[model samples]
Target: MVSTQLDAHEGSGQNSESEKPTHVETEHAAVTYQEKNAFQAHADESGEGQNTKMTKRRFMALVSQAFLWTGSQIPVYLFGGVPPYIYADIGGHDRWTWFVLANLLSLAAVCPFVGSLSDMFGRRYVALSGASFIVLGMIVCSTAHTMNVFIGGMVLAGVGAGINELTALAATSEMAPTAQRGKYVSILIFTIVPFCPSVLWAQLIAAHSTWRYIGLFCALWAFVGLVLTALFYFPPPRVNSEGLTRGEILKRIDFVGGFLSISGMILFMAGLQWGGYMYSWKSAHVLVPLILGAALVVLFVIWEGFFAPYPMFPRRINQAPRILTLTLIITFISGANFFSILMFWPTQAFNVYGHDPVQVGIRGIPVGFSIMAGACIVLWLLSVFRGANRSLMVISSILMTAGCGAMSVARPDNMSTLWGILVLAGLGIGGIVVPASIITTIICPDDLIATIAALTLSIRVIGGSIGYTIYYNVLVAKFTSAAIHYIGGAMVKYGNITSTEVIGEVIGLTSISLLDEIAEVPGIAGNEALYKIVIQAGQIAYAEAYKWVYYVSIAFGAVSVLASLFLGDIASYITFPKYQHDSQEFERWRGVRMSCEHSLAEIITENN
Candidate 1:
């Protein structure tokens, strides 16, 4: 039945006299074209057949893909604005809860399927659809007056972001010049390096007008991109004539893979997102979902390998792709430290540097600037080296280790002397992201490029989920231990634990209508002299938390170093690079020469 159906659809037949043939060929000419595609996968085992040439229009499509990739972060971070001003109708914590929920939800659910679908459909359709969803999501956020509506908005926004990634990095692998894929992917994402999601951007915008406009603004920007897809399209096409069909596309879509992968990721992310804020790390609410999520992910891998014909992470095409392997390990560690430092460092600023939340955000501008600078410097270095993928990775790991170690030295009472140290950490973090992306796009096969990109991203999200979870657990344990030790240190220095002056100075209780529980202790005189004991206690508590965060980052970098060492040699994995038969023979000969050299070297050395 399948063969008949395929044969019936085969050939360029305008065999019927009634129908007019528009092209230079018969009506069924397209049908023959489809047959070539349908069996193309089976015919070419070495992946060397002449497929199709890339054109200017496809390059434009690739460019559009990059835009979609970087734009994913906009909606994720834009929520930082609207939630602070959330009316009581939506709980003050409602915005944060929704923001975290939306991000985490996509990691597990929409993101997985979007990636699989991108593999099945083309990058353009999935990406544009995601953009449309993002636009509507933003509009919903703009007008959200109720909790249900707000939640609904977040889901839409997240779905768009999920699909956004499919186009960006994945499409880059497909559309970029064979030799230039790594450079372009890395350079393109660098556009967003300077655009950090500090609460300041949102706060500044909200000062003059309502915060809801932030959502409206994002929606408008996405709408513009949606329009630009047509204008930027070049005349010549870049479609590869690989074996892609509607049924094959549908089968590989892997609804089951999507469901399991996304659900597990979402549940795990939830465990981390709310771990410290809402419940203890060990609480059933946190641990159970994380456990279940892990198990589900295990099942997903099993299903992908043993059952799904066209797996999401097809082992055949990957065969230990270098960039992806390193990306998984490095991104895991980076993902953990990325937000943990930003979220916790403000406490150090408040207690150690004696700054309020506003001042804390203000003082961290150097970190943000350093982040942008680090990205540029890393790009320049990588560009200079000509495929120094492994070397760049080592430099990134070293910087991460150094930065995390320096941040561990931070004190709540005195950060003035070592502000530069904090900026160093930011530089390390920024350095990691772009290089990892460069590797991911270059080392993957053309047919499975999107799938690999999606999988790499999914793993990063998974690492992020687990990273936060582990950080929370460490934070609670260390905070407890440090609190006890800090109390002893304080009592030894001061004569009492909870003296009136100490408590009063330490807890700068706020009654502001907008931010009721904001703790903003001012001046060295008041907090230093009277609240010394209370301030000291908070310092001890925070140091403990920061200590584990530091150790975790160090461990992450250390393990990543080992992973980096094993990355094998970097090579451009262009699928059908100017697919000449002679070129194919040359590649085969090159492989044979490499194998013969290794075998001779082993024999010569052993005989000696």
Candidate 2:
């Protein structure tokens, strides 16, 4: 690998949706004095002809993108199984609220700023800076003094995460051959596979040490990313075809859409996650924020669609595939279907499976492994059958819907059913990601790819965060209400029925873990005086909660099915938005790589 100083040259590169004008591009026709070097000079491997490949830069670039990719969604995904696994000591309900609130706040605040800064300066600088933020955030979180500080740390992590998250998608989409988009993104999608390691890390901390170890362990990953990026020399993909410069990107920036989107997502998550703990879902405190949040989202959509120039999601992209948007939404919603199960499954398994906390977590290993395996298989199949993207999406949705559907119908006694449904869910997730990537790749143009990728992730994170909060709130409420009803007020007045312990005894059992279990128990006093409310109330409440998880899945599944039907297939990308660089620079860069894959391909196939 070799580094080069700015040779004071010009060339063509692709333009992105975010670019404005550039200082150099503006003065191209006019003569120049000294060249302004906004970019730090770095070495790139040179090749004999057109076969140039920057091995060191590519390695570091992949390392950075892959590392950040691993951290993105898996942390939250593990929370599904983990929240239940840790909710007892850490205060499960409160944990969700703060986690979502903190992280969303970070994402909402950071993504646009990172995008804008990267838009103005460059992706490399933004990514490295973000990497530093992640490292700092991890240390802060590892040493968090209280819940608030933890939230603050997560906010910092989110900022770093936002930067890291966008790099691979944006970079890969721009660099990969058009025909290879699905496979390329799928390969990157495998980064989530590393997330399973986090589960082990989290479990180790939860069981052997403090949860702080989880955050502390993340510091290592972030540090590795930092080192890789700081040393890397990946050539920037052409994103400023129109010669957009730092000054212009800042000037035309739309701060409002970013603000409203972030604030709305944060408030909504906080309120929903707080339900039952901070305030009942129906109570004024929770209800007010939830309403306010919805209103803000509405305002954000209007503001972005009508007011903001270069909106995060421009209207043209929206116009292309309505169903694709729906698919993204449903994938997130159904992907999150296990929240209620995660909340209560361990408790249900306690007496039923006779497993302790550690054993229960071990039991969840299958579910975790299952999700990873499913995704790999889907990625493989899609790679083999490139045309199956749409079909694959439908299949993914169906799998998810079925899996969650089965879970919603499970009873405390039905351990087999519970495990089976979760496994199905794992398989469904495999199919979801590949198809979803294909959808995004096909529908959106290259210029908007980076912004859209960032937007998609944010939306999915918000959906998963809120979905769990809402699901858990309803499940917990119903179970609590049923427990109370089954205890019988008259018996309670007589000092007979007291806590869940007494309620458990009334049901001819030692414990009750789910709302539905209360219905199986015999009515108090054998239907004696004032017994009407207790017997039926338990049944009704349990039934209500049981309906939600399944019903929501079916609804989302139907929507996704429609979304799959509405997608449009776009063609290949070869000559990208020509960055303002002239033929000389293009030839120069190509000359550097002429000995790499490009030259090798031409030479090997020149006969054809």
Candidate 3:
């Protein structure tokens, strides 16, 4: 029955009798042309076949796919703009930090595995499962009353989100024509532009109601995506696989290697988070985890290289050309700088200017819009120049360094200046991230594009986790010192308080509303003069601390600039023909030669 249906569809007659081919020879020639074109599109361009026209069905499918990717991204943006009052509702001083850490860690850990799962099962099934997990995670987060429970829910949601993100990206790439992959990806990412206003919406909801409702909104978004996928998105059939039983395929998974990689990263990142905040840097709690985690990561690489029958890392492809590997490192620095700004810029506004959640969200608009503008700049650069990527990256790094340098001098009185500075930072981040992705796809083997994509996502998330941890610690340490020097005894002379310990307690429990609480102190209450003095002192201290973060951001940006110098000539990836089969074969042969030489050297030494 299936065979007959296939034959009927292939031989279906045209509406116009004159245009229809009556001869069997003509019909065979027509089918062959179509078949060859389809093969070239998928097999040559990393499975991103080109779509020349936008039919109604194709357009609907693109919208559905874009929504899924957008839904995955919304949670990160929401958390980045979360207000100070919302932290109190969650009942912890550092719960926001933990929440961010948990989310990034889960994303890093789950991304590589999700890519493999989709290939083994099917894209649609994997994506549906991800959405279901997100639904469950939202329910947990909405009902949670404790910080620990909330973080647990966020971790669960991160896993689902990671799966959906990669799946949606892969689907979008495959759905569009090869020439239009960038367009599809940009559309998917830009879906967030319309919803950037949701930051303000979340703030309003938090002010009038509770933060739990924000989680509910995200749950509903994921649910809608789930429905769309089930109805319209069908997974394409795989072209290559050897005959094997289901159990055999399951047994081939590199479970041990995957666990080692994920666990090592989680441990290392947790140590970075704990140091200088929860424990001293030299304490057993901090040192032991960091050391053990490093060891485990080394073991993971050793295992993947020698023991694992099916390794997680793409050893051969990673070494050829070396651009993919180099870009991953550059991406880590870029990711770090991007997240550090997004997470901390709002805190600076609220702490220094006494801005509320709504005000903070409004100030953040420039940064969000700047990111979209940066992506557009790349598109324009590609059209005008032959090998424009090197110049684009260098330009992005300069903007980032200049922007961060400018931010160090920002004062509450000169808050207007921040609008322009944020634009530069956003432009730098967006510019680097998008081009890195496109370059990776162009240089990578068609069969390994999904794996490489997952790897890049992991690198970025892990880098973000590291960046947040470092910047948060720097901010805390700097703030503590500055507050002690400027506000401790200085305030005691002016205020009713005899003890400086009272001021210490306030600084210890850091928040945007720190100064507002100083007025409520038992000894300092009802003295407007003393309250004003303390508030001024606090402002000066926060501004100094923020300067330290800006300085570090500038340093990271400089390093990214140095990395860009090494990324010579990507003109071939841009202008050359897709699927240079001879080039790929030569790379594989070179790898084989190198491996044999090393083995032969070892055998010769043993005999001697």
Candidate 4:
């Protein structure tokens, strides 16, 4: 392996043979600069090439984009940590489902359209608009006096997040050199690095100050993002080949399809969330929306396939059957496992262990850091190998499977063991995102980068919403039945002076804080042994219920591993079109020697 560089004199067609690009002879192949056109050669000379250092101008542009990136992602993980305050200040637990669903539904609805619009118009304006929406939403949330207003604010915020998130990723991919794209995108993972800290921060602020101040801080953060985007961020210019006008662009909006998809997703998710908690599966409250949502999904597919002038998701990319299939599969499974763990593990810490918000947040630091570390690991691997990411995917899924399986057996006595399991699961979850993003970037045409990125992200969000709903239901059912069984059995066997109704009432409430309060009631307060029995029963119930959800996650992880095997090798697909380099053919020939049956070390040795 050798480092190679090309100057304008080498390939701009302005010099004689002596000025041609140099090549380095290697054991397998000669490494050389590849120029697709004279225009690119000139562009490379202007310091835009992979080997050239980025200009100060371009570095500042990335910094500006990073501000927007942070503001957009703050709303995502912040809510996961501070839901208690949200429910208390805005709505009760009964309305908690709406708060979560509002942003997700709006995000799912808007992402495809936002990506398409950015491609149609420009990234800078779209990003500015996204930042503006976030600011407005945060303000509304901060000032809201009613649950309805708060939900509305969340929906707006979700729309902004949807636009900014995908646009930032696309811009990063387009700006960075092919070899360094993974490195740059890995930086985006920092947006969620506050997952644990945000919980602690929000709790600290809420405890000493007001929860509303947190919203104000985010609003101001987005305001700064808005200013930075306006002053600095600008993407390369593009125009439609057909010379489409404003009206023409509007005609290609695919409003009907977007509406159907968004509405369908919201309805289905709402149904799932309400079914076991607020309403029974047989109730019309759940069934009506679910059936309607399913119908709309069918309509969405039909419209995209046959009716839309320009589909939200391009059909051409779907032609790459294996890559498309694997991308969705891995993203979907990982999304489910990722969300279930993030949303539930904290609940376990609070409920079974009687930890406060700060303690719960502290307990989550291992998982949060592990996620960032996992993403960094993949970036390093991609940089070193230049592209064989299939192994990383397989390894990540295996770890996730093992981690979740381990979690299913966690007992209250050994709850500390969750740290190890969470680390493995977080690593697996974070590792999975990179290969899928890289594969999508490599397989699709340069023009469709944003559109494809948005499509893939939307799929992950939808998968997460589905996962959250499923796990919420699973948690409720398991906790309710288990709690009833343990408490009722204890009451019957040791029919003491304590009221069974009081125990049942306490079990009905889901908040962890209530469990602590229940132990100090007048009747049980004087009886140390009875209080111990009650607390022990509550811990066992919550922990056992949590284990069931973990088991389900294990199943998702196992399926992800099997799906990853069919992802093909990433090395074969990676190509730097801007540099006119393609390794597809060479990778094919090389595959014959690096067979799957051999040890990984043997394969690496043979490749070297």
How does each model score on TM-score? 0.67, 0.70, 0.83, 0.81
| Model 3 spans > 4 angstroms off | 1-60, 177-182, 236-240, 243-245, 319-322, 509-516, 573-608
Query: What are the per-residue Cα lDDT tens digits for candidate 3 across 207-262?
Result: 67888887898889888988888887764542213433345546666789878888
The candidate 1 region of ten consecutive residues with least summed lDDT is 599-608
Residue 102 shift from truth in candidate 3, angstroms: 1.2
Q: Give the Cα-based TM-score of candidate 3 against the true structure.
A: 0.83
| Candidate 4: pairs in clash | none
- Tell me the lDDT of candidate 4: 0.64
| lDDT preference between candidates 1 and 2, better one | 1
Tens digit per residue, CA lDDT, model 4, 1-608:
00011223334433322332101000010011221121123222222444436766566666666767777767655665666666666566666656666886687677767644654666678888888998999899889877788888888998888777666655554555443444555565454555446666666666677778877988998888788767766655433324455566677677888788988887888788889888999999999999999999999999988887677776765646786788788888877777677667766776677656677677767776776677668646754675566777889889878887788876778767778878988888877765565566456543344455566677777887898888888888898889887765554445464566766665654443354455555556666776667666777888888888888887788788988887766554443233434365344323311211111111110000
Worst window of 10 by summed lDDT in candidate 4: 22-31
Task: State the lDDT at 363 in candidate 4.
Answer: 73
Residue range with the least summed lDDT across 10 consecutive positions in model 2: 599-608
Which of candidates 1 and 2 is the stronger one according to TM-score? 2
Candidate 3, 374: how far from true, in Å? Answer: 1.1
lDDT of each: 0.53, 0.52, 0.65, 0.64
